[model samples]
Target: MEQGQAPNGLSSCYRHPGVETGVRCTRCERPICPDCMVGASVGFQCPECVRNGSGTGHGPDAARPRNIAGGAIAGGDRQLVTKVLIGINLLVFLGGLFFSGLVDELVLIGLAFDPELFRVVGVADGEWYRLLTAVFLHQEVWHVGFNMIGLWVLGGPLEAALGRVRYLALYLLSGLAGSALTYAIVAPNQPSLGASGAVFGLMGATFVLFRRLRYDLRPVLGLIVLNVLITVVFREVIAWEAHLGGLVAGAVIAYGMVSGPRGKRPLLQWGACALVLAATVVMVVMRTTALV
Candidate 1:
C-alpha cells in the first residue's frame, strides 16, 4: 500500500513508509500509517510536531519576568486591537455610569438578555441583540477592567497570528458560544455581559498555538487549570459557564485554523462554527422555553 493509504489490519504504521513502523508519537499517538514517524529529541515525536533541542529550556515568553500576582492577569505579547478593545470597554463602562441617573434601567436592560429572549416560539422575542452586543457590555467598572486585561493578554498574540478578520471571528464566535452555554445550561434568566468569554477563548487559542509550535505546556496547563478552579470555587458574579464554553470552543477553533501543517479553509471553518452556534441556540430554546 502507498504511505498515505489506510490499512485493514496487518499493515505497516502511518508514521513510517517501509520500515513496518508500529510506534506513534507520545502526545497524540495515532498509529503511524507508514508515513508519519520521526525520531524524537527525547523519546520520539510525531512527524507533525518534531522540535529541535532538548525539551528543557526557556518557554516562549521567558525573556520577560512576571510578578507572582501579575502573571495571573494575562500572558504573551501585546497588540493594537487588544489595546483598542480595552479602551472601548473602559469608555462604554464609564458612559454607562454617567447615564445611570438620566436613563432608565431598561435602557441598559435592553442591551442585555433575560431568559424570556428565547421565547417559547423558537424566537428571540426582545433582547435578542444580547446574543452579539452583550460582549461589549459590563455591569461594573472592575468587570470591564478585568475583562479588558484578559482581552489584552490573550487577544494580542492571537490577532497577530490570525491577522484581523480571523481573530475577530474567533472572538465573536467564542462570546456567542459562552452566552449560549449559559442559557442552555446554567441560568437563562441571568443577564450576563463581559469580555471574559472572548478572553477565555484567547487562552484556548494560545494553548492551541503553543502546542502546535511544539512548545511544552506544563506551565500553561497548570495555570489554566488553576484559573478554572478559581472561577468555579472562589469567585462569585463570574459567569463560569460562559468562560468555560468559550475556552473550549476557542481552543478547538484555533487548532483547526492555525495548528498542524495544513490550514483549514476559513469559510469552511467558520461554517462549522456557525453550525455549532445554531445548535447552541436550539438547546437554549429547549431549556428556557415551553411548547404552546
Candidate 2:
C-alpha cells in the first residue's frame, strides 16, 4: 500500500510515524524520507541492511561524522590545573631554598634525587622521598621559569582533556616514572633536579594523544625531538634519564585516559596506569638495593 496515496488503513509511507526513513533508499527506488535511510559512502539504504550493490553517491553534505582530530581533550572540561600546579611547584621550590639555608646548591642538592641519602636513612630510607620531591624542586631561577611556562602551555589543554585529577596524575606519574628509569639506569649518587621529567612526560602524552586522534604529527614529534636534543647538547645539568622516563610514562598513561573514536576502555586505562606506577616503585627499590 502506497503511503500518503492510501485512504485510512495504510498511513503515509513517505511521512509515516513508524515508517522510519531518510530521503530514498537509492537502491530499491523506495521513498525513504528520513528514518529508514542508512548512510553509506555512496548512498542511503532501506535500514534493513548495507546495500553493497548500491552505486549512487550521497551528496556532498551526507551527515558526515565529526573530524574530531584536533578538538581539545575531555571535551574541554573546566579546570585550573595550570595555575595550581605552578603554584605548588613554586612553593616547594621556595621551601627547598629556605630550608637549605637559602643556598642555591643546597636547595638543589637537598631536594633532588640523592641516591646516597636513600641508601642511608633511619629505619628504612629517606632517599625514596627524593624521587617525589625532586619533581617539585627546581634549581635555578630560570629553571622554574622555563618549566612553568611549558607547564602552563601543556597543562591547560591536557587538564581540560583529562580533568584536573587525571592531569595531575599524569604529571606526577610521569615524574615518578622518569625518576625510576633514571635510578634503574644511572648511578644514584648523581643528584638530579628539575621538573624536566614531568615536562617531558607531558610532551609524550600530547604526542600520543594527538597521533591517536589522527592530527598532524610532524609538528608534535619535531618539537619534542628538537627540545630533547637541545637539552642534551646545551644542558649537561639536565637529568636525561628522568626526562626519558617521564616521557615514556606520560605517553603510556595518556593512551589509556583518552577517549572518543580511538580510546581504550576506562577501566583498562586506569589499570594500565596503576601497573606503570607499581613498576616504577619496583624499579626504585632495585636501585636502592644495588651497591652502585
Candidate 3:
C-alpha cells in the first residue's frame, strides 16, 4: 500500500477523506490537504493548528525585542535601519582615512553637497544626487562620532514608533531640508557635510512624538535649547541654519505622522512626508537657479 493509503486501500487526507495528501501537520501530526496547509518553520501545519496560532516561528515581538525603557524611550532592540545608517557613515569616514583619493574625489568635491556644487556643477551638469550623498560624508572623527552618538541615542525609539519606512523618510527629508537651507542662506562657496542635520531631525521628531503622547517635554526641549545655544555660540563653525531647518522639518513631519486621519494614518503620514520632500526639492531648484 502507498504511504498515505488507509487500511481500506483508500488514500485520503485526514481533513478531507475524498482528497489524497501525503503532507502531515507538524504539530498535530495529521494529514493535511493543500488547501488546509499553513507554512511553518519546521513543516506545514493544518488549518486547525494555524487558526490556534501554533507555530515554531517567532512572531514580530519575538523577532524584535521590546525596549525595556518602554517603546517610547531609547535603549532597546537596535533598529536595523538606524544601525545601517551609522555603519555607512563610519565606513565612509574610514575610507577617507585610508584612501586620500577617495576623500578628495568622493568625500569633499564629489559627494559632499555644497552651495557652489549645487548651483554650478549640479544644476548645470545635472549631478543632483549630492543633496543626499553629502549626508554620509564626515571630515573629522569628532564630526562623525557626535552625529553617530545622536543617531544611536534617538534612532531606535523613533524607528520603533514611526516604523522603518517613515523613520527613514523623516531622516532623509530632514537632511535634504537642512542642506537646502544651508545652500539658500550660506556663502555661495561654503561647504557643508555630515549627518548633523539628520541627527537634529531625529531630535526634533522625538520632541514632537513625546508631546503627542503628553509626556514631559522639558528634557527634549532643554536638549534642543542647549544644542541651539551651541550653534549660536559657534555660529562661524557650526551650520546652525542646517540644524534649524532639520528641526523644523522633523517637527512638522512628526506632527503629520501623529495627527493624520484615522484609519488612513499611514497614507496621510506618507503623503505628508512626500510633500515635505517635494518642498525641499523645490527649494533646491529655486536656490540653484538663483545662484546660477
Candidate 4:
C-alpha cells in the first residue's frame, strides 16, 4: 500500500467514513481525508481543531495571548504580511524593467498628459488608482533598495506588534494620506512615486509604539528630526508634503492603536484609523474638485 492509502478497512476518515486515509489530524489524532486537512505549524489539523483552539492544546474557553493592539498572538511567521508587501513591490519593480511604459500608467500624478497613452490622464481625470499602484511601483534600483530596507526593518516589528491586519491598514492608510497630501499641494503636472511616504509613516508609528511600550524616546525622536531636516533640505527632490502627511497620519493612527481604555480599545483604535482614512478621502476629493 502507498504511504497515505489505508488497507481495506483498517482506517477511514472521520469526516468521510467511506473514504480511507492514513493521514491523521495532529491535534485530535483522527484520520482525515485531504479535504478535511487544514495546514498548521506542525502537521495537518482537522476542520474542528482548526476552527477551535484545540490545535493549540487549548479549549474554546482558553484565554489566548494577545499583542499590544488586541490581536491574538499565534505561532509561525510574524512578518508574513510585510514579506508579501515587499514581494509585491519587487515584482512591480521587475515588471517596470520590462514594460517601460508601466511607470507612466502607475506613477502618482494629479493631472498630466501621458506620452505613451497620448492623452490627458491623471487622478483628476478619474484614474484614482494611481495613488495606490504608485505605492508599490519603483523604477530605479537605488530608490527601491532604500525603501525596501526601510520597510523590512520597520515593518517586521510593526506587523508583529500590531498584528497583520492592523499593521496593513496603518501602512495603506498612511500611504493614501501621503498621496492625498501630495496631490493637494504638489503641482498638477508634477509626477511623484516611491515608498518614502509609507516608510516615513512607519517611522512615525514606531515613535508612538516605543512611547507606548515605555521605551526610550530619544533614538526615534532623533531619527525623526534627521529625516525632517533631510526632507526640508531636499524639498525640491523629495515630496515634503507626502512625508509630512504620512508622518501625521501614522502618528495619529498609532496613538489610537496603543492608547484609550482597555474595554473600548477595539472601537477607539479602529475609529481612529477610520477617521484618518476619511480625512485622506476628503483631501483627495477636495483636491480633485479644485483641479477638475
Which has the greatest lDDT? 4
Q: How do the residues 104-193 of candidate 2 rate in per-residue lDDT, one tens digit apiece?
A: 332222223334333332101444666676678776899899889888887776765565667788899998888778767764445566
TM-score of the candidate numbered 2? 0.65
- List per-prediction Cα lDDT, in the order shown: 0.59, 0.64, 0.70, 0.83
Q: Which model, 3 or 4, shows the larger lDDT?
A: 4
Clashes per candidate, residues 3 or more apart or on different chains: 13, 13, 0, 0
Writing each residue's lDDT as its tens digit, candidate 4 over 1-292 gives 5333456744678888778765666445577888998865324668876676554434653345446675675578988999999999999999999987898989999998877889998999999998888888888899899889989988998888788889999999888888889998999999988887888889999999887654578998998999899889988888888898889989988889877755587997899899999998899899999998
What digit string (tens of lDDT, one per residue) describes model 1 on residues 50-106? 442221225763333221111211234436566777777777677667765311222
State the local distance difference test value for candidate 1: 0.59
Candidate 2 global lDDT: 0.64
- In model 4, the runs with Cα more than 4 Å from the true position are 1-62
lDDT of 1 at 129: 57
Report the lDDT tens digits of candidate 3 across residue range 26-142: 444567778888764224667766665433235653333221111222344438899999999999898878876454344212222444333334321355666677778888988
Model 3, total clashes: 0
